[model samples]
Target: MATKNVVVDLTKREKLDGTNFDMWHRKIQYLLNEQEVLETLTIVMMRPENGNTAQHRYDLETYESWVKKDHCARFTMLSSMHNDLIGEFENYPNAQEMWNQLKISYGGTSATILRALTLKFEKYVMDSKHSMAEHLRTMSTLIRDLKAASNNLSNEQ
Candidate 1:
């Protein structure tokens, strides 16, 4: 039997370690090295807006070249999803404008995604009524697990 698939929307603000956190932001940053990944991400995310085949090909070529030349050292492959989706096109001086325009061209798909996440978080905050001890406990457990995994990996090596 095929396993059931569960989609998790993790952009909602969640409490952890006694603090409210943007789970999506943390996940994105954890997957990417800020400096090295930004350049490639800028180009990729902006290409759809420009819709120039030549420009798209050029950005891809440049991205390949930079990777080959190790100009992307701070970046890791773990960030590929975001890199492929939107980060790569963010380098242009007017990339924000490009994205905003793309957002319109795409029938507000991006805006819808943002709105969904925002609504989920807002509802969660309201439902929780600001109690966060359970969230803190959950975070502590996650941290402990991560530390244990790291230690195990080091020992294995």
Candidate 2:
């Protein structure tokens, strides 16, 4: 018989820079699901109420600790991957809070940004100073934002 070992490394994860949270979020979701620890972002374990036996109390404590530990690990790992600053969420008790904080911080105000970006996309004029490749790259980045905002540019328009 032969022995083999495999090690998986998850590095260079997509960053959550303010301009691209949607893409960052989907990639992070994939990474979390792959790790079999995605649910820690949502569920929180609660300690038992009064009238429980000592054994039951111990069990609840154990479960709570594990849940917190999992959430903390995911939270710390996630924060490090961000290009935008998320230090305000350092004290959040769970991954869910961290996720929500990102959403709240970057999510609500994006409609205005999308509108501005869309207008910019609509008004983009090619520059004679830039090479064709550079102009295309700039256009492509804008078009990606339009698509991310669920607004597509048809061939006619």
Candidate 3:
């Protein structure tokens, strides 16, 4: 059997501070998926009981595969987090639990944050002095922020 080796370069990526969970979550998800390890964040594999049977050996191989993938996924997540946040998450026993804990801690958009994002989008005006590229980049960021805050706007808007 052939194994796939994936090399991901995260040096250019932004670390996940407490304030950037939405963007960080998306990037981490993409990286995990690319490595074919994203399922480790959602599924738990049980270790097969020790036995002499061939079936047990096959099960052990499957379990070990899960463990390897889980470790990769967990490491990738921790590497992308800020130093301050890493200490809080590094001790999790598995990627699934760590992912759940992160969501519970930072995934929700509060009413105030949502409102602020909406207001910012509504109030943004392109300054003619800036280049069109700059204006487009600012607008794109505002749109992304609003969407991440759960204020989903239609493309027609």
Candidate 4:
């Protein structure tokens, strides 16, 4: 019989902080996928109880161990944020709910945010007085924001 135990190292990373939700989401997502626990975020393993069979005991032990490891990873990443941000997610029992809650609170509906970003980009104009670098920077930033908002435009645009 093999025991499933994970020794997790909670490394602090600013990229996981809520200040930049787009980047933070991507970074944490990549981490979870790489760790092979992305599915655990959405699919919670059931704790088999009331059945003393060997398979039931095995299932319970494995499920609990996996949940703990998954939770540890999620919490460590979230710990990078300020305490106030932490408060918003404390009620979630698993990483998937926490991620979804954060997304809704910070990102809003994709259509709504995209409309705003598109309008902002449309209104942006580079002044002749500004340096070429400054002009490019302004345009590039708006473009990046629009992309993050899930607005895809053809290269011609």
Put down candidate 1 lDDT per residue, 1-157, tens digits, no spaces: 1111110222222212111123333443443333334444344332234445997778877656655423332222212223244444344244234334433433222444444433433343322643488766654544443333232223322
Encode model 2's per-residue lDDT on 102-128: one tens digit a residue: 788766546776777677888899999
TM-score per candidate, chains pooled: 0.23, 0.58, 0.72, 0.59
- The whole-model C-alpha lDDT of candidate 1 against the native structure comes to 0.36
- Most lDDT-accurate candidate: 3
State candidate 1's TM-score. Answer: 0.23
Candidate 3, superposed: residue stretches over 4 Å from native: 1-11, 111-139, 150-157
Compared to the true structure, candidate 3 yields what TM-score?
0.72
lDDT of the candidates, in the order given: 0.36, 0.66, 0.82, 0.66
Model 2 TM-score on a 0 to 1 scale: 0.58
Model 4 TM-score relative to the real fold: 0.59
Task: State the lDDT of candidate 4 residue by residue for 1-157, as single tens digits.
Answer: 0111111322333433333567566656666666667776667666677787998888988988888867765665566565677776777877777777788776643565667667777887889899999999878866776676667777767
lDDT of 4 at 74: 69
